[model samples]
Target: MTSSIVFDPLLPWPLLAVLAVIAALGVLLALWRGLPGWLLRALAAVVLVGALAQPSFQTEDRAPLSDIVLMLVDQSASQTLADRATDTEDAAQALAARIVARPNTELRRVDIGDGEDNTGTLAMAALNAALAEEPRARVAGIFMVSDGRVHDMLQAPDLPAPLHLLHTGRQGDWDRRLIVKSAPAFAILGEPVTLILRVEDDGAAPGDTLSEMRISIDGDTPQSFDVPIGEDIEIPVTLPHGGLNVIQFTLPEAAGELTDRNNTALVQINGVRDRLRVLLVSGEPHAGGRTWRNLLKSDSSVDLVHFTILRPPEKQDGVPVTELSLIAFPTRELFLEKIEDFDLIIFDRYKRRGILPAIYLDNVRNYVEQGGAVLIAAGPDFASADSIYRSPLSAILPAEPTARVIEEAFRPKVTDLGHRHPVTADLLGQETWGRWMRQIEVDPLEGEVVMTGVDDKPLLILDRVGEGRVAMMASDHAWLWSRGFEGGGPQLELLRRLAHWMMKEPELEEEALWAEPTGQTMRIIRRTLGDSVGQVTVTRPDGTEDQVQLEEVAPGRFEAVYEGPEIGLYRLAEGDQSAVVGLGPASPKEFEETIATGDALQPLIDSKRGGVVALQDGLPSIREVRDGRPAAGRGWLGITPRDAFETLDVTKTPLLPAWLVLLLASAMIVGAWLREGRS
Candidate 1:
């Protein structure tokens, strides 16, 4: 297919040039001297020099290679929202057929799925990878069939040829998105936290701008109200308890919209206590009193106010303030004034010694009824006539003390109920537990008897008042375990669980339902006191429901891993308890802007002389255009023909033979000699 002249010199070109110069000089000298046959001699010298310069006619056999055309099909989640999926499929088929029909062209079709981990549409990244795999010289064109909501636009590759985008979705398509502009991951419990949110419609949305919004916590019944569209609204939330709290906001889906996935947004905020204020009242100095104080003081988040009544009201001897080493307890400020501010109050070995009046004790009783926690660590005095149970505080006490104390050594035992209770479940290996030497006899009035001592008497009882919690431990010898008695049991851990449970920690709740999102799967957890748990109903963002069964991993803990097939908020319900958790991001990158537009891909397309044409109008025909020229027009998309080829074989033929040169030179010499003889 290609031909050219090639040379192979019999002698070096430098030596040939010298011989030609000498021959030309000889001819010039003879002509000047009027010598015969000077022209013949010069002709003979030229013929010999030309024969030394070997030249051949070269020809090559070549094969033409087809130009490669790449088609990027975007099948991400957004593309399936409405009729965009149909548009994309049909357009891709049409374009592939058209490209294949062209002369000497090959088609490479690549499908783009949802980006990993909800990264949205990776159209550009996928296209760049496809380009890297093919030969750049042979790549004639690229096309994208998508909704145009690409997230990785910065990864667009340099155009080997023009890029043409056949957009899906119609101009009248619209979507409503609920955006949580700002939400903190941590919030203080019992304090109002503000969340900034906005609900707006993209594309064309009809009806009033004011839309109804529903807000729910922990998947409870949502509260609805009208919120103005296109405005950031501040929603104040006061968390009911501590630990992970899930709040979900939703906008009711209308008749015609892309999806309701973006219509709902979920925000998880961990509720933590700003400060745990504890009131510790000790009746007298004892060996175990320091254990409670040390435990509470060790936590930096706890504010401990400890008071030891060293001198009772009966101490009216001549020991005045000068001799006494104690100051009066702030009973009025603690029990009456600031009792509600404290999260927990401990009555350790405390008895009615007249230090705190009946009025103060009554106030403490009222405090427990109004969402406060009370823990009574009993000592020998708890069974005496001066026991605090004799005061008005006995109204909320879970047990009533009998005037008897068991002083025999016996290891404390966890009751059947305690094995199912979060506070004492899985606390220790019961066989290795140490013994407590003393325990007060008490009759369970109203509460759960979680622990027992010798003769199966109540050692620990827990109960809930109106909106608060109360706990009673019948023995003061728990410090023996802390001191490593008989291979010390889980004393610290038990006490910690008790304190947190009394403070209403969500993880320490006896009954709870929540879901933790883990990479496209939700670890649905259900904590209950019941023997068996039921199936959990999962409600997807698309209003589809799935029943998932839970497996018991521990005595009271049950869980199941549910694979999340879609992105957005998922509601889980097991019996009376319901929970809401966002498996993937509630506002996914794909659905962030559901309405199709070419703004993101336009710049990349323009850089390569490409154009974005909506498929809703029509599937454009394919054509071939020159490189660097406009490749997109009103009714067609263009690809450039690279005109590239590969050579197979080569051949060469000499222009002149050695015998011909010799014959021509001999004739000229004979003619010159004849002419000279005639002269």
Candidate 2:
């Protein structure tokens, strides 16, 4: 109910000014002529001008809207730590009740959660979003209940009213965290790779030191060593094998520390082969020999040593014994002296000859037993007496020659077991690859037959002996398949899988189980010939076991997915088989440091001129103070109220009406003249 005066004009200001000047001049003329009626004439003219302007009263109807108080609550991972969650819940409920109790005031609660990855809290972003939803005029103030760790401080909105913070942490809260400053993805086996690690103390008292750090590989006994505070230290770690290696680093817990969860860290490094040394022995010089050489030499990682036997001992093409063109083969140095230097030995159509004595063959067998790979490509001579199976190498060979060879054109087909084996599975679709001609027949002994030729005879046999593997391709005509004689086969993929399988690649194992983490879920895969696996027993971080049944999705591939409830290392086992895989980072954002403290949110509090108030200090009462006044007190924080008002009634008075002013002015001048003449 406010009131104010308003004005209303009937004519333009210029016309009104001209009329005033003319009237003033007329009055002056009458006065100078000694007319007594001049004064009365002036009074009449003013009255007429006032009656011409039309005016009216104006009023506005307004009902006051409720004042808005925004309450931003930090519900992120950091807020869930220790007693902070309970503190925040209590503070939020109390603040909401107080704001609602005030006359004509409303409370808007905004919950802030964890950001993607380890990006920290997004407090300011939440604040900006809440501000946009409220009416600017009715907004009284903003209040935030959070730990001091806000990541988006620069994004805080330009608040129309004062902003207050009710922090939810204690002053003496502290934490110790293990930080992996640097780590590489790949490392050479048996070589020491330096990883930079640091143990940091946050919100700790000055002069407190971290005494010891323990490092371990795959849950083994930890090696304890001294580590200085606040400095990066290099720890040299040697990978023991060629595969995935998990390393765990931990720091000793100090007195008055916030939480021990963040005191440890886990890292995974993929181990690579030191070197792929290959020894290719060719029995005779042929076009297929060049194909094997070209394939092995093309790879930069492969160390290839090619040795070809161009002439046998029984050859009589030499002119003389001393003047022969062929040189004596050094079978002793190659097969016996340096055989251990090679990781794999490939024989392309090689046969037993007097060149390589029985003693050398025995050394080759020992080489295969001591973690070495061997691949034999048998030819027509495999059915003859000169076959390598007749030599000392027969002990390591997976197949024996039947002395009856089938020389015919046929397309090789993968067996049912091979379809599930990583080597031949998905070779070229099931029925879609080019065909091969000229497959030499052989009989496989106690090995798995992956491929069969004409008459359903084994063409490719694979077996394991000792710690090593042996693969026998009973056909030297595989090059014809590469040349697309009949059509063409998956010659390249077949050859690659064969070579890698012989090298004992983990992925190609027939009976294998592995799991990989994908966010909160894990993909558990098992490759086996069994129709179905028994219930897979899963051991969680909390030492709870859950049996999950696996379903056969493909011919031999079995899989069962499990979603981990928390982040940590998960162990999966079925019968005698077992595997270990990490689900997430050692210290997840939620459990990084469970204790609530103001260290993380300090920057935000300092920038906004706000301070932390622990719930243990008693839940403070909320109040609305005037703008620019102090917003916090001994037991509570205050939200400032804005001074705002609105206009209600307005009345405008008319200056003059045009017609009345004209008639009165005409009469005034005539009457003035009459009075003067009478005088």
Question: Best candidate per lDDT, number?
Answer: 1
Global CA lDDT computed for model 1: 0.87
The model with the greatest TM-score is: 2
**In model 1, which runs have C-alpha deviations exceeding 4 angstroms?**
1-61, 204-212, 216-229, 240-246, 252-261, 322-325, 399-416, 428-446, 451-458, 480-489, 518-520, 537-546, 563-576, 582-584, 645-679
lDDT, candidate 2, 1-679, per-residue tens? 4334344556776777677778788778878977799887787766554544344344444445678888888888777666788888988998888889998788898888887755567887887778777667778877778775677667866666666667776777777777888999889877999999877777644565655888877656789998888889998999876666778887777778766667777788888877788999898987678778877787777899888887676775756768866666777788888898888899888887788889888888888889889999887777788988898888989988887767676778899888888899878754655555556667677679989888888989999888788999987777775676556677767887888788876777888887877765888888886666787888886789888888888878888889988666677888677777777765566555445556655554444344567777777777767766666678867665654444444444333446656677777777777887798
RMSD of each: 7.1, 6.3
Against the unseen true structure, what C-alpha lDDT does each candidate score?
0.87, 0.76
Model 1: per-residue Cα lDDT over 1-679, one tens digit each: 8999998888899998998898799889878977688888788878777778878899999999899999999999888887878878988998889888888999999999988877888888888889889889999999989888899987877889998888887877877889989999999988999999998888888756898999988767899999998999999999876787778888999778888878888788999999989999999989789989988998898899999988787877876677766777888988888898899999999998888899999888888898999999999899999999999989999999998988899998988888989988987689898888899999999999988999999999999998999999999988988888888788888888899889888888899998889766989999998889999999987899999999999887899999988766788888899877877775778888988888888888887788888888898888888988899889888889998888899998876687888798888778778877787
Given candidate 1, what's the lDDT at residue 64? 90
Clashes of 1: 0
Task: After the best TM-score superposition of candidate 1, give how far the Cα of residue 651 lies from its true spot, in angstroms.
Answer: 8.9
**Which residue pairs of candidate 1 clash?**
none
